[model samples]
Target: MDIQKIRRDTIGCEQLIHLNNAGAALMPAVVANGIRDYISAEETGGGYETADKYSAELDQFYTYMAKLLHCRSENIAFTTNATDSFNRALSAVPFKQGDVILTTENDYPSNFIAFISLQKRLGIEIVTVRNTPSGETDLEDLEQKINTLQPRLVSVTHVPTSSGLVQPVAAIGNITKRYDTLYLLDACQSVGQLAVDAIATGADFISGTFRKFLRGPRGAGFLYISDKALQSGLEPLFPDLRGAEWTGIHAYTHREDAKRFEDWETAFALMAGSTAAIKYLLDIGIQEVQTRNETLTAYLRHQLGNVPGVQLQDKGKHPCSIVTFSIANQEPERFKQYFKQHGVNIYTTARSSAIIDFTQKGIEWVARVSPHYYNTEAEIDRFMQLLTAIA
Candidate 1:
């Protein structure tokens, strides 16, 4: 990779040391310009006419996503964000009053809240799979739970937002596949940071966003539905005209593809930006990005470990680019403010973000520093110097 060119392509590198990729990445110039160009096109022509004119570009959104996910284009559906994708995918699964939904302690907050709502409204049971000693999803415990509970759906987050803890989705998939249970994998944090294969992961539904490590515009995400899920006649709880054809007075036929989960209106500019971001990643190669990111993460981890009063909080067998830690006597808000003042960007993860894990670990909150591949070693050194002075 041309490190200089990569930094040049990212406009923020010159002014800020952005380590908050988990929150939202620095959008590339290509993506931003593409979105602006699309908006200009829409204004020049009519709204509907512009959409028709850009039909090929809009369709490439699916093609690009399919390439990133290693899935068929027909299986992908656009959404406003990862939360939207997850909600839509979850609603498609028929949950009964007494059905069980299995999930992990490290699942995203929005999904956890959705599960609670389902429990209250439908009386569905939410079972949590305990983590192992290393703080990963326990495969043995998960297998036992699958056999005993016969869960209606097995949900797991590919990577938790709070830390570098990456769950073993493939192993979990093995158990879910054996039991013939439906599986939903939240890949919002994992999709762009690492290479993912829908078939190898064995997730019936995978939800993700392009705004994070994908470096695309916000308000754009997607859901990947497996061929089996489509064949099973799974339909969204509320189908709009875009997703279904109204046949009679009270009858409608939902589309067979994953687009059935999509609504009528969409942000075409954002979609165009998302397509450009995917194409950029594909051209550079995900494997290369992953390797570079791992190197940067290792350097940051080593430097942070050496700083006095700093405690590394991330735990996983194979942690990704996300690095979480806490300063000895600094409030999270103050810490964030100090960094912001220094032209550094980082975020904090509250206990409520992952209640079960945070409670078990006795942590109220922690600062998260996530660096992408475009970041330089010199930048990491500068960050360490700033942190040491603060300490």
Candidate 2:
């Protein structure tokens, strides 16, 4: 793949140093133009008429997503964002009293809160697996927990938002398969940065967003439910008309496909834009993207490691593109503002985001810089120079 040509297609890099891809990636020109054209068509014609005109392109959304995840189109469901998909998938599993939910300490805050809320309401038990000394979840401990607890469900985040540490998801998936446990994977950070195959991952369900690494619109996401899950008659807590059809006064029928988790109305423009974005990534190739991001992150880490009083917080056997660090005498927000003033985009994470992981590591907040495939080595060098000057 031509790396320079790919970077040139992302116009935002010319205006600002965007290192906040973990938050939201800049949309490529093709994706932006696609969304604008769809909106213009809607204004010129009626909503229904405009949809009819681009029905084939809109349908490609599911096809492209399935191709990306290496899953069947029937197993995919369109959602507004990762949170929406995660919540919908979680709601589908019925949690009775004393049911156990085994998760990781590095899980996203929203997911942790959701489990806590469910536990409070339904008398379910929430169990968090211990993390290793390097901040990744301990696979041995996780297996031991599963053997002992025999939990109702097993869920984990492939790549956590708070840090760049990649969890041992495939190992966990192997364990789940051995015991016939339901596995749910939150791939919000890993979907575009790494190869994701639902069957290989052994996950019964997976959820992710398009705006992060996929560089799509902000409100586009998806969910994948295995055929076995569908066969088991798992449906959302509150199924809409699109998800279920009212057969009679006392009966309803849910769709056999993963669309059973989705609602009737959706943002068609965003859907089209997401499809274009996936096509753009496919054109560049995911393996090439991963290689570029890993190289950039390693360069960034090498430069940042030399900064005075700066401590890299992310520790794992293998890391992705997220670079997180904390300065000895600087506040996270103040440091972030310094970077902003210098035209470098970054973000800060508090202990509340990953409370168990942060507190265990004795960290309050840290500055995070996440780079994508479009980011160049020169940009990483410049960011490091700026960090040194500020420090």
Q: What is the C-alpha RMSD of each candidate to the true structure, in Å?
A: 0.8, 1.2
Candidate number with greatest lDDT: 1
Give candidate 2's whole-model lDDT.
Answer: 0.89
| Model 2: worst 10 consecutive residues (lDDT sum) | 1-10
**Residue 146 shift from truth in candidate 1, angstroms:** 0.8
**Over the stretch 1-391, how does candidate 2's per-residue lDDT look in tens digits?**
6767777888988889899999999999999999999999999998989888998989898898899889899999999999999999999887789988999988889999999999989999999898888878788988899899888899899998888899878778888988856899999999888888888888989999999999999999999999889999998999999899999999999999999999988899999999999999988888988988888898888888888989898878889988898888888888888888988899999998988878877989988999998888887887888888868
**What is the Cα-based TM-score of model 2?**
0.98
Counting clashing residue pairs in each candidate, in order, gives 0, 0
TM, every model: 0.99, 0.98
Clashes of 2: 0
Strongest candidate by TM-score: 1
Candidate 1 error regions (>4 Å): none
Clashing pairs in 1: none
